[model samples]
Target chain A: MCGIVGLFLKKDDLRPQLGDMLTDMLITMTDRGPDSAGIAIYGPETEGMVKITVQSDSPETAFAHLDAALCAAIDAPVTIKVIDTHAVLTVPEASEAAAIAWLEETGLRIMGSGASMEIYKEVGLPKDVAARFGLREMGGSHGIGHTRMATESAVTTMGAHPFSTADDQCLVHNGSLSNHNQMRRTLARKGVFTRSENDTEVGAAYISSRIAEGATLGEALEGTIKDLDGFFTFVTGTRNGFGVVRDPIACKPAVMAETEDYVAFASEYRAFADLPGIEAARVWEPEPATVYFWER
Target chain B: MTTTLDMTATDLRAVNTTLQAAARAQANEDYEIINPRGAHAMACGLDGPLTVTIKGSTGYYCAGMNKEATVTVEGSAGPGVAENMMSGIVTIEGDASQYAGATGHGGLLNIKGNASSRCGISMKGIDIVVHGNIGHMSAFMAQKGNLVVLGDAGDALGDSLYEARLFVRGSVKSLGADCIEKEMRPEHLEILAKLLEQAGADAKPEEFKRYGSARKLYNFNIDHADEY
Candidate 1:
């Protein structure tokens, strides 16, 4: 099991200082997920072709080689960088789907891609990852963080989440995708490149691609909800705002506490027990198959 | 003296106020409570040397989160009694609902009657005594607790049990995953006797049988998960 926390509010909304509160929420849930942590802040640049992650052990060299290939293949400049263990790339003019297919043809797996979000993750305790990326200081109107305990995938930075693309779509998840391999095949036929072995990233890419192609985040999530099998509390943040929903069967635990100040969700009540104003607040479980969303 | 708190005073704050008044009335002395009508979470979130008694049935989470307090319910209780409790005594004079004694870090729970499903789930370091039968899935996922049932137990007893010892006197409906019936020793009988005596159950320990985990699911082995 993993723990996920996200705060959503309208732009320039008046809310109290919650830096320490958010950290405390994450810290309280360390027992649920002890592997890795990552968070992404969505801001101004919300356009352009998405950079898809391709997993090659030689991330730096693989990204460099793939950059040259994309440049030669699409006749457009490709921007690349070796961020920690994973490499991120942005193609100036080519469609993200086309770039993903081109990269897959070269046998490199696409890790993640989006134009609206920047994602950073690594393997370790939450504090270790927080210290690495300085998560304490990162702030946004809405942001999501994940502490993963690598069940189906290796305990690596790649498995850590709030998987983002060059576009503005980012997602963090708690629970498994039992039918991920089958869904990955379906996405592959549509030229969606998936890099990480973690099924969460695959689900993120699928939903984000749908939203990028004119589907609302809620609609894309609704489409994926029927397609996605097994227990999951899927939470996604788009440029419009942030939305959280759960799968049909209520197999995993997800509790919610929302106020005009902000909305937050976690795998347990104890995680959100210390949130500001949660005392005397209404706390309830996210019912199975229900779409209770908060957007501003 | 015993007093009556009617059903309308069922809210937590109301119950807290009454309990405080009761505490003051019985200051520096032993006390008892009677005729609390359908109040959920009665005497919950309290810590004291005070002894509380509830005479009738209850709703969810009765006597939850007690500390150093001795609570006695003469009738049936709802779910989650003594949940996450630390250092106390909660004796149910009748049957109890699911999740009884859940996550109890310390204390003793004496159920003079039967216990419903999921009893002692996730229990930690508490001593539980059940004089009568217990329902299905009792003690499921229990950790570091001692559950003693002088009578029978229902299906799936001690499912996913972790370091918790269960002693049942009669037939088990079925053993749960990773749980096994063990040979009862003289030392275990002594322990059961002491627990029964504490609960005023006065049952014979020789009639009881012990159950516990087989220790297979401790480390999260992928291959062995199918067995779970």
Candidate 2:
């Protein structure tokens, strides 16, 4: 089993506390999974700049002088902020492709890239992963977190959740897919390939491919219900939207709570017990095979 | 007197052990559980008379294998509430997750709100009354007991059932294989009436449609050997 938590703040007043609230919620579900933890935050967007999050096992040498190297390689301004084993590289929007290509050549794993999204994930407990990333101090408008139990893949940093295949888009899953290999082959024929052998990565790539083909977030999620064959309760985060969908035979548990301030999703209600005004929130389980989305 | 237990202060094992001891002694006490925070296995496996009221929602297996206890959840319950209960009354004021009261031998499970998939699945000698709808594949292979639903039922109600009685007041999405609607006779009406009253449901018994097994799949016959 795995645990997934997502928070989409409806009001800007709660943006500053998004990380704190999501971290607490994820920790409450630590018992559901102990293999690895991951989180994706949609923070404030800087005009003309894109953020590329990368990870390396040895950050001391991997991140050393990374800003100047990337600046020279892309022939543009670059800034790198190191946090534990991960770093967020901010560069010109036009240089995103060059920067990503240069980072890939250096053997750094690209976690995600977007104007507003920064992803941090590692092979450890949720609490430790959150602490290493200074999750409590970070601020965002919406975020998604996952604690994986490692069923379809090994317990490695690459296997952690919140798999991102597109800019400002990510997905975290709670159930395993049986037909991921088949789907992966189908996607490869269309020029969409996954980096890891993990099944959830294929799921993320599927959704991104759909969105790239001009499908809306709701449509992309509905496509999963028809195309993806397995037990799944998926929470996907885009630039300004948070979407949820469960398979028709949804055995994996999911609970959602919504207040005027925010919309929260968790594997259990225990994660929501500490939210402000939780007593007055409208809480319920999402219907199977139905797509629910909240957008600004 | 009402004894209060704060989940944040006391561990779950200690709280359950204390209640179990009181039940074994036949103390017949009343307990109030506060700040449940959706914890699993709240107030389970009692052997004597006791009244437990949980102030908030609970996680999986709340009141499982209950005996001679009246456990009430003021809020929603997670999966497998009152599972395999021997004898008792388990009540949920809010909705319940999947497989509520599954395989219970004897008990009355009352849900004021909707119950998710497989509500009362494989039930044996238990009485379940739902105030709202029940989800898909409910009462699958039910061997015995009465399941009363005041609202609609999801797909495949009472699939491959045996001897158990199903009473639905609203429309059924579809019936499962070998589970068909039977005429609501006087005895079934009486059973439904008693279960509804005990569960505090307001619907009239005459509005329900009874369903049971066609007695086709369980027994073997020489003529059906080729099909098997």
Candidate 3:
């Protein structure tokens, strides 16, 4: 079991409160999953620039000289901002691929890469993880968070959620996949690599591959009802949209709330109680085998 | 005298203690629970006659195993509302999520709005009245109870049903094994009328259809092998 949450802001005034609100919602679900926590934030983007978030077990050594090394390798100016074990590297859009290849050679794991997204996660309680990363002090337009119970994989930083396979797209899951091994093999044959053994990451990669092949987010989610096996409720965030889907049986619980200001999702309603103007929000349970996505 | 408890404190333990206290008092005690905010396990394990009103929605297992208390929710309810209840009255003013009134025993549960799948599943003794539709697999394995629905039932209604009586004013998508339509006789209408009266529903019993077990699979008869 795990807790997953996502928020897509409709009003620009609430962007600054994104992290604070999301942190409270994630913390409220601590009892659902207490092993590890992670979040993906989509902030403002600038023209001709891309950001890649990466984490390292030995941040002190791996991060040292990283900006200089990558700048020289890509022959482009690079900037790195370090926060705990995670760092966000900004580079010219044309140099994104080169920068990622260089980082991969350096042996640092790529958490996420996109024009505007950054992911941070670790093996610890959500409250502690949020505090360590100073999550509440940060601001963004849309974000998703996960607290995992480690039902299928080991409890490690790489095993945490908010898995991303493509730029500006990430997903958090609340259930297990029965056919991930087969799906992972199929994806590998097609040249899409999934970095972790967790089924959630496989699901993320599946959606990303579908989108990469030119399918809409809605179409990719609808395909899961037929292609993927096992009970699952997925909340995926792209640069401009927030999407939700559940398996046909819908064995896992999921609730969604929408207001004039934002669209929010959680494993339960308690996570939404603390949101501003929630009493007036339109609350409902997303139907099984249906995809609901909202874009700004 | 009436007491009010604001749940902004989010202290479920304290909210339940006050409910227990109100139940045992000699005088007629009334309570208003404000800002429930979808907290789980509210009004659980009550054993005394009292009136309690919750101002907002609740989470999982709200009012589970209740007895002798009249509890009401002003808004929607999450999964398993009034689950396994025994001898009480729980009223939901809005929609209920999945498994409403599951495994209930001896209670009156009224959902003014829709209830999701598996409503009144494994019911031993409960009277459930829903003004709106119910999802699939409702009343499955019910031993003894009455389910009254004003709206349509989804796929597989009354699956594996036993002893329990079902009355639906709307259509049934399908019936599970050994569960079939039965004649709405005068006695059945009379029983349904009383249930409707108790639930404050404004529907005529004669306008409904009755469903129950065919009893063919009750004793594991070998003659029904193909059907099984």
Candidate whose lDDT is highest: 2
Chain B TM-score of candidate number 1: 0.87
Compared with the real two-chain complex, what DockQ does model 3 have? 0.69
lDDT per residue (tens digit) for residues A1-296 in model 1: 89888766543532233334555667666777888876655433435565555556566566667678787887777777665555567775346767777887876644455554556566778777666555556455666778887787888766778776435677888898899899888888878856677798788878867866888777887877798887788888776577777876444556666775667776655566456565434544454566766666
Tens digit of lDDT per residue, candidate 2, span A1-296? 99999999999988899999999998998999888999999998889999999999999999999999999999999998999999999999999999999999999999999999999999989999999999998899999999989999989999999999999999999999999999999999999989899999999999999999999999999999999999899999999979999998889999999999999999999999999998788888898899999999
DockQ, all models? 0.04, 0.78, 0.69
Score candidate 1 by TM-score against the native.
0.53
Preferred candidate (lDDT higher): 1 or 2: 2
For all predictions in the order shown, the interface RMSD in Å is 10.1, 0.6, 0.9
| lDDT for each residue of candidate 3 in A1-296, tens digit (9 for 90 to 100) | 89999999999999999999999999999998999999999998989999999899899998998999899999999999999999999999999998998898889999999998999999999999999899998899999999999887999989999999999999999999999999999999999998888999999999999999999999999988999999899999999978999987776888999999999999999999999999988888887788999987
Error of 2 at A263 (Å): 1.0
Prediction 2 global C-alpha lDDT: 0.94
TM-score of every model versus the real structure = 0.53, 0.98, 0.95
Per TM-score, the best of the predicted structures is 2
Worst 10 residues of 1 chain B by lDDT: B26-35
| Model 2: per-residue Cα lDDT over B1-228, one tens digit each | 999999999999998998899888898899999999899999999888999999999999999999999999999999999999999899999999999999999989999999999999999989889999999999999999989999999999999899899999999999988999999999888888888888888988999999999999887788978986
Best by DockQ: 2
